[model samples]
Structures are given as C-alpha cells and as structure tokens.
Target: MAKVSIVDVAKAAEVSVSTVSLVLRKKGHISQATTDRVHQAMAELGYVYNQSAANLRSQKSNVIGLLFDRLESDFSIKILKCLIRELEKQGFIAMVKTGALTADALTLAVNELKTQHVAGIILVAAGSVDGGLTPVLSAAELPYQVMANQGGLGMSDLIVCDHYSDSLTLTRFLLDLGHVSTVLFGGELHDPVFGERANGYLEAYRERGIPARKAHIIYADTDLTGQRQRLEAALRSDNSISALLCHSPAAAMIGAQSVLKLGYGVGKDFILSQQKYVTCFQEVDRLSDGVMDLSYILLPLEEMAHHAVRQLLQRLDTPEPLPGRAFSGALIR
Candidate 1:
C-alpha cells in the first residue's frame, strides 16, 4: 500500500542509505558487490526512482512542449520532426500535443503543459488573420516560440516562412508562363499568414496591370476536402484558366488530383505552384511543364528550431527578457 523508497532498498540490501544512493547514481566509489546488492534489492522490492521529482528539485524539467494546429497536417509533421531532432540534441525530451487552434483549446493545452512543468513550448500557430493568440500565450507566461507561422508579438520567438513575398513570386512566375488568367487558391484570409499571401496575390495582379477580381480569388476552406471542392468548382467553371497558385501545399496535391480528374494535365494544361512550405519528399515530381524546377517554397525548419530552442534555453537559464523575434523563409525553385 505504501510507495517504495530508497530507504526500503537500503534496508533490504543491508547497506546504508548513502551507499544505496551512490549505487543508484553509479557514483561515490561504491564497490561492485554493493552496487549489485542494491540493484537486486531494488528489483525485489519493486522500487522505482522518481526521476521527475528529482528533476523538479533541480529547477529544470528537461521537458519541452510541441503544440501544433493540426496533428495530421503534412507541414505540421515536418516541423515536428525537425523540432524533435533539435530538442533531442539539446538533451531535452519533447512532448507533443495538437488541435490547439481555438482560443479555449490553446488555453487548455497551455494549462496542461504547465501541469507537466515543461521548460518551454513550441507552438505551430494556424496563422489566422481573423484571430490571434499573442494575448493568451502572454497571459500564460509560457516561454514559447511560434513555428510555421508569422511572428508579431514580443512575448515569443517567431519562425515563419515568408509567405507574403513567396506568394508574389509564385504568382509572377505563373504570369511569366504567358498565362493571362490566374487564380489564387488560399485558406482563411482572416489568418495573418494567409492574409499576407493573399495580399501578395492581389499585389501581383495589380502590378501586372490586371484587374483584381474577387471571382478570380477563391478563398478555400481550412481542410483538404473543402479546398478540393472550392478549387474543382473554380477550374471547372472556367476551363480557360491556365495558371493556379495555391497557399496550402497539402491541399495542392489534392488540387493536382482534381486537375487530373478533369482530364487536364498538370504540367501542360495548368501551370501550378504552391506558395507555402513543402515537406521533403523522397521524389518530388514537377507539377508544371516549362518550370525549371518543382514550384514550391521550402521553410528552413531546422534553422528555425535552432533559433527557437536557443531562445527558450536562454530564457530558462538566465533572467533576461527577450523581444519577440521573427525568422523568414526562402523559395525553393
């Protein structure tokens, strides 16, 4: 009924508590025989050392929280992998959680991680222009970094792909392909990141002396199915549409499939380019002909993680405060 402790192991092994401690830690010049006895006694008594409790005494939990917008999203998985590898290198274990897109969900997740006594948190914000989490994270006092999302607040470190600029680049590339009519498929324009990319799309058209038509700019839904329906309808209505630029890479694959289903070839009929971050796949096929390479932007996730972890550790080690930092991304062909 009682929890097993080191004292019980020491008593059973006929050794002092100090000797048992030294043996358990593999320190203090304890003899091999005494170490063996301590181990056997521990096994016999079913004693488990409370490492978490010990870690609390040292004021470092060696735990980091990874919060994502959607667990199943492809970009989320890519960023998570990079974050895990970086955290492991720093000698910290990463605990991952997802579906923290809403305000209540984000608040609840932060509370849960706090209960676990995590040292820092890496949040993959949904980049909703219609919403914000800066106030919530600031209130929670959780040292955090924003990943796969744009940075704005001073409370956290921000690592984001330059969505606005890259969108313009992709759109211009489509124009350069001699495609007169262009359509930009995007998610919520209320999200900051999406909003930025949408602005880029509009700016590209305006610069090229093209009229900014709302009908040409289709704001897709957040998920894949919604985006597929929206894109399919847009393309089906106007078969004259020759170029398509999308902001969601995961949804872009679906768009490609939709294009195929409509008896249109991707590289030939519709020049396609995804404006958002892409995961490193084993072999990426070029979606559009005449393009020098696969049309996509690649976020530097490892570098982002390195900056985030460094900031988090600095906050943990010293008492100095840091302003919110922003990291930009690059376009990969």
Candidate 2:
C-alpha cells in the first residue's frame, strides 16, 4: 500500500494541500466543517499521523515522560493509559518508562526520556521504599510531577487520591453489613498505598469497638498466585473470617476463589469490600464468572491522571512548580 500523505488527504477532503497542512498542524484558523471533513477523509483513508517526524522538524517536542515503578500493576497500567489519552487530547504525547522504583533505575529512566527530548516527566509510585524514586527529583533537568501514593514524599506537584479515607469507607461499609471479623488482604506494607489501607482497616475496627486480630491482617505479593496461596491459607485456617477488605482487584478476585474453596458463598457467607479502580467491576465479572459481586469504593484513577497531566502542561507554560494536591474518591456500592 502506498503511504497516505497530507496531499492525498487534501484531495480526498476536497481542500488545498496547504489547508490540510494547516488543519493537521492545527496552525491557522479553519472552519469547523472543513476540520470535520479533513478528519473524516483521514479516517476513511486510514491515515495515521507521523508525530515523531513532525517533532523532528519542529523546535519544541510535544512528548511527556511517564516513569513508574512497575508495569506489573493493573491499576498503575490503567492510569498510564489515561495519562496518554489526556496528553493526546492536549496535543501532547506520553513517552513511558518503567522500573523507576529504585534510585538507580529512576536515574536511568529519566536519562532515557531526556534523550528522547521529552518536555517533562510524571513520576508514579514516588514514595515506594522498595521502589522509591524520591532522592533524584529536583536534580533532573526536566520538570516532573509525582503521583503521591498515600504518604509519597517529593517537592514537585504531588498528585494523590485519598487511599486512607477510601479504605476507611470500604472497611466501614463491611462493618455496616454486620461483619464483625474481617481480614485485610493484598499489598505489602512497605508500599504507601497498602500501608494507608492497612491503617484504615485497623481504624474501622477500632471505631466499631472490635479488636482487630493480628493473624487476620495478611500482606501478600502482587502476583495472582501469591495472593491466592496466602488467602487460601487464611480461609482454610479460620471460619471466623466473615468479611474481606481488599486493596486491589487482584486480591478481591482471589478472595472470592479462596472463599469458594472453603465452601462459603460470596455475599451470604462472606461480604467483601474493595478499593476498586475504574472498570475493575467489569474485570471481576469477567474473571470470576459474575459470582464475585460485592461492594466497592471508587478510586479515581482517570481523574488523577487528568489532574496530573493538566498540572504538567500548566508547568510547561508557566515553568513554575505548583503545590501538591490530594483528591478524595467516592463510594460505588
């Protein structure tokens, strides 16, 4: 197939090549009808824009760096996608780099983005100790913002969703359902997200005047198999565990499987509360065969991404660091 060019789009859309160029670059003012026609023509011809080539020919690049601790996390990966879309809507691109959990890894990732000529960087998991990227924020040439997961520490525009309050809400919901004995599962304590969630679970127990048993609080690895193994053991050993509070979708699904293995129903035998990212319910429904129905507290992954990108873009124009922000999420069930 011949490479589709701007000229071809111009001819198909019945406009001059210069007008097509203008529309593509978003340079000069054009009628909305013409813009729609140009877009339609491009779509009809399956024309993909060459953003890299355009950046090469231009002085300033529209690429933004997205550095994170691990690509293995579903919640973090989903946030990465939202960041890409948000930047795209603002006429920018996301250049993603993973393995920035450690100081050395962060330095290498930032250097990688610097070579790509990215305008700025967005650092996720900035407070992870086993995967901390805190020591090298201000020294880098590129401007950066941190997604302050719970107690994340950094000087840049720190964006945080209320993991503490949301976890507390999920716990309180389970308690409201008359669940006296509950287990707090998923995520290791070194990670700020899990740490905050663990605290919330304890807080809920304290508020209800119920003593939180030490054995009930289990921290598992992020992997599905590990979550299943740990949860299965917990369920097998105890029949008193009537409710579950999970920090991630993976944990919630495993909790269901473990519950079933121990001959317990999902809702009637055991109520579950989850801190869910957007669309986690669909995934749970698909994976658990629609049996893992439970209450959930919404974690605003999309909103967090939107705010993070907007903050970065604002910094690009203003070149001044903004104060950190923390957003609270709402209940879904």
Candidate number achieving the greatest TM-score relative to the actual structure:
2
* Model 1 per-residue lDDT tens digits across residues 202-276: 888888987665326667665767777887888777766766666565445665667666766665334354222
- TM-scores of the models, in the order given: 0.60, 0.67
Regions of candidate 2 where Cα sits further than 4 Å from its true position: 1-59, 99-108, 126-140, 148-150, 154-156, 189-191, 213-215, 221-240, 268-283, 317-320
Best by lDDT: 2
In order, candidate lDDTs are 0.66, 0.70
Query: Residue 13: error of model 2 in Å?
Result: 24
The Cα error of candidate 2 at residue 284, in Å, is 2.8
Worst 10 residues of 2 by lDDT: 274-283
Summarize candidate 2's per-residue lDDT along 207-244 as a digit string, tens digits: 88887673267787657787788777876776666777
